[model samples]
Target: MDTGTLALLIPIMALSIPLFRIWTKHQKEIAEMEVAKTAERAAQYAASNKELEDRVAVLERIVTDRGYDIATQIEALRDTREVEGLTARSESGIN
Candidate 1:
């Protein structure tokens, strides 16, 4: 209402505008950094999930695919090792 009061209020309000702008800018920058960090974490999780999916796919194939006939091969290999062990023991005169 008075000229003296208006003069005092004007400078205070002007100074507050710049301080408000600085505070808002600082908050915006911090929010952007948080968003970026969250996005990075999400990307890492996605990559880890993809790798696990790939490993699961390989395990599924090993379990379900019957074309390899792995059981017979393993048995044959075991028989071969037994024969070799016998031969080695006889050569060494160890019974």
Candidate 2:
């Protein structure tokens, strides 16, 4: 209502507009960065899933193939471990 009060209010209003604009711009940039990070993480998960699927396919093939001999291979691995255990025990005089 008075000229003195009006003069003070004018500068305050003028300064607030630019500060609000700057704050909104900062918020927009943060949102964009979060979106980019989320997309990158999604891509990494997809690649990992693809690798696991490939490994599973290989395992399925090995298990289904007639000549693979899964039982024999497993027994062979167990035998090697038992032989190593016996050798270590004998060397340590643990009977």
RMSD of each: 3.8, 3.8
lDDT of 2 by residue, 1-95 (tens): 99999999999999999999999999999999999999999999999999999999998988888466888889999999999999999999999
Against the reference, the lDDT scores of all candidates come to: 0.96, 0.96
Encode model 1's per-residue lDDT on 3-89: one tens digit a residue: 999999999999999999999999999999999999999999999999999999998897688656878889999999999999999
* Worst 10 contiguous positions by lDDT, candidate 1: 62-71
Candidate 1: pairs in clash: none
Top candidate (lDDT): 2
- Angstrom error at residue 22, model 1: 0.7
Name the TM-score of candidate 2.
0.68
Q: For residue 8, what is the lDDT in candidate 1?
A: 100
lDDT of 2 at 45: 100
TM-score of each: 0.67, 0.68
